[model samples]
Target: MSLLTVRNLNVNFAQRQQPIEALLDINFSIEPGERLAIVGESGAGKSLLGAAITQLLPKPGYIASGSVTLRGKELTQLSPKQWQEVRGQRIAMIFQDLMMTLNPVLSIGAQMVEAIRSHTRIGYKDARKMAIEKLAQVRIASPSQRFEQYPHELSGGMRQRVIIAIVLLLRPELIIADEPTTALDVTIQAEILQLLKEVCESHGVALIFISHDFGVVARISERTLVMYAGKIVEQGATLEIINDPQHPYTQGLLNALPQMALPGQRLNQITGNMPSPSERPSGCAFHPRCRYATERCSQEIPSFINTDVSIAACILLEELVSHEEEPDV
Candidate 1:
């Protein structure tokens, strides 16, 4: 059985005027110990997907129609009380901003111990020992000394590592990381990625890494899902998508990477900003910015088509498939 399955997931915002769809027809499955990456622009509904899965959506946002099953247990149907039992223990989340995630007043050890004891029957002393061990596991030197330090006392990278250690305290089956390395320096980001990859593998934990950078996820995830304007435009093996992206948006993203640029040449850029949910264009949401878009693209939403290399939702791919299948005279 899949570790997690999300089918026909739709997230909507309740507005006084009318309900606005934030996520539409989202579908995917993650296997046990597998790592998946959700990559897209800032407004592509990446973080919203994570929030919906974890039942942490902000006010006015709610799952409208869909099912989220984790290990055969339906998560969307769980009550707040039931969710408390599952969260942290079964599914932990590591956010991008460590300062916001870590309490400024509480010492690292206090928070870790509280989290451990909240989900388990362990006493304070045992929880403290476990927390220190986790801190050490994340490669924090002098774990005991760092345990007493407040959030402000640690660097950004250290705080992120602490967050990872806390996420490990319960040995969660899955970890939803939302751009955990975005705020760190390049070197620190690389180190954190490697550490995260290793830790998840060693713990046998599935990971859903959310990020806007395709390059960043290349080193961590085995599969990639490309989202755009609240829809999944493409999905396939990580290396396959990186080497031969089937969707225009995915191609544009890979092109914009710094590594894709030649020596002394300006990096390629995808023109136009992502559309807002409230003002999303008609038909294929990406048609407005898609260079290959035709009049038909603006008039009809494209359903996902098998592209051999990757599954993608685009009319161009459909045309290509049809053309290739036609026999020559």
Candidate 2:
């Protein structure tokens, strides 16, 4: 059985006039120890999807029609108390901002001990020991001294590592990490990604890694879901999506990636900006910005059509295939 399954998950918020759908019919499943990455530009609902899965949607946001299931148990039906039991113990989330997740006044030891006591019946001393071990697991030097320091005393990377340590300490079956390395430097980002991969592989943890950086997602994720304007436009193995993107939005995103070029060579960029959430286009949310969009694309939403290793929502798939069939340009 899949460890986590989210089907038709819709997160809506009440606006001045009507309810704005932040996420529209999101669907995916993760088997045990599987790593799935959700990649898209900002406001593409990647973070919102993570929040929805963990039942931590922001104020005025609620799940409208859908189900989030873990081990075949429906999470949407869980009461606040039941959700408390499930949140940190069975499912943990690593927020993008470590400072928001950590308490400024509490020492690392105190915070971790509290977390352990909340989930288990261990004594404070035992919990402290476990906390120290977890800090060490994340490769924090002088775990004992670091545990006694407050959040402000550590570096950004160190604070992030502490958050990760706490999340993995419980060994939750499913972890939702929302751009956990966004604030760190490139070297630290690589290290953190490696650590996350190792922890999930060794503990059978299903990970939903949410980020906008395709390069980071491509490095660690086996499967990639390309989201746009609150919907998934393309999904496939990481390599396939990077090498043979079917959707115009996906192609544009790839084209914008920084490439190794000769001196003075200008980098390509995706033209135009993403539409505001309230002003999303009618038929296809991306139609306004899609280079290959046609009348059909602007009038009718395309169904997700399977293409062997990938699935894409694009009316121009046939045209794309036919063009590829012709001789090299």
Candidate 3:
């Protein structure tokens, strides 16, 4: 059975002048010990999806449609008090910004101890011990020393490691890590990715890794889902999506990668910026920037079509493939 299942989920924010559809018809699932990556540009709502599943969407934003289930239990129907029990215990989130995960005013020890006490009936000393052990597990030197230090005291990588340690403290069933390595250097990023992979495997914990870096996604996840303007435009096995992206948006993202560009040439870039939720296009949200877009693409929304390779939402998908398959005249 899937550890986490999100079905037809839609999210909206009540803006000052209008209602913004932050996420639309998002659907996916994660099995125990499975690693899935959500890749998209800045406004694609990856982080919002993570927050929604954990029942922590920022204010004025809410699940407008669909359901979220964890371990067969419906999460969307849970009370806030019930969610308090579920949030860190069943699903923990390691935000992109490590600072957001830690309390600046409190020492690491205090925050970790409080988190443990809140979820489990553990004594303060025992919680501190667990915290130090997790700190060591994340490869932080001087665990006890680091535990007593504040967030600002550690380097960016170290701080992120501390947050990972805190998440580990809960021994969660699933973890939503939102670009946890983005702020770190390349060496540190690789180390952090390996650490996450090891920890998840050791615990048999499922992972939802939200990232814009396709390379990182390919390295860490078995499956990948591509989102654009709050919609999942394509999803498939990680390697398949990397080797053969179907949707134009997905192709654009792959082409924009530095490795995909020729040497001494300008890097490929997706022409336009992602549209805002309020300013989203009428039909296919990606139509404005999609090179293969047709009049039909601009007039009608595309539904997810199963092509045996990947599930893609693109109006011109069949035509695009046919053109590539047709014999030259």
Candidate 4:
């Protein structure tokens, strides 16, 4: 059975006029010890999907419909108390901002021990020992000494390591890392990615790595979901999508990668900006910005179609398949 399954998950922002759909018909699954990346631009609902899975959506945002299941258990049906039991014990999230994720007033040991105690009835001393060990496991130097320091005292990379350590305290089955290395320098980013991948592999943990950069996604995840506006535009193996993208949006993203640029040339970029939920265009939300969009694209919503390389939601792919299937004269 899949470790995690999200079926038609819809998230909406409550508004007096009408509910704004933040996520639409999101569906995907993850297997045990597998790593999947949700890739898209800002407001593409990558983080929102993460929040929906963890039941941590921001104020006014809620799951309008659909289900989030973990190990055959339906999370959407869980009550507040039940959710508390499932959160740290089964699923944990690593936010991008370390400062916001870590408490300024609490020492690293204090925060970790508190988390451990909240999920399990361990003694403070035992929790502290476990916390320190976890810190060391993430390769933080001087773990025991660093445990007593506050978040402000650590560097960005070190703080991220602490966050990972805290998430590992509960030995969660799945970790949702929401751009955890975005704030760090390039070298630190690579280190954290390597550490996160190694930690998950060592622990036999599944991961949902949310990122906008294809480069990072390629490094950390085996599969990739390309999200646009509020829907998945493409889904397939990471290397497949990176090497041979079927959807225009996915192709545009890979094309924009630095490695794709010629030396001294300006980096490529996709034309236009992502549309907001409230301002999403009819038919295909991405139609307005899609260079390959046709008149039909603006009038009819595209459905996902399977290609040799990936599953993509675009009429161009559908038409290509149709033409190929037609009998020749």
TM-scores, all candidates, are 0.98, 0.94, 0.93, 0.98
- Tens digit of per-residue lDDT, candidate 1, span 141-166: 99999999999999999999999999
Model 2, stretches more than 4 Å misplaced? 260-263, 318-329
Per-residue error (Å), model 1, residue 72: 1.3
Stretches of candidate 1 exceeding 4 Å from the true structure: none
lDDT (CA) for every model shown? 0.94, 0.88, 0.90, 0.93
Q: Candidate 4: where is the Cα deviation over 4 Å? A: none
How well does model 3 score by local distance difference test? 0.90
Could you give me the TM-score of model 2 versus the true structure?
0.94
Q: Is candidate 1 or candidate 3 better by TM-score?
A: 1
3-109: candidate 3 lDDT, tens digit per residue? 99999999999878778889998889999999999999998999999989988899999998899999899998899999988988889988887887788999988
Collision count for each candidate, in order: 0, 0, 0, 0
* Ten-residue stretch with the least lDDT total in model 3: 316-325
Give the per-residue lDDT of model 4 (tens digit) for 20-114.
99999999999999999999999899999999999989999999999999989999988999999888888999999889999999999889999
Residue 206 Cα positional deviation in candidate 3, in Å, after optimal superposition = 0.5
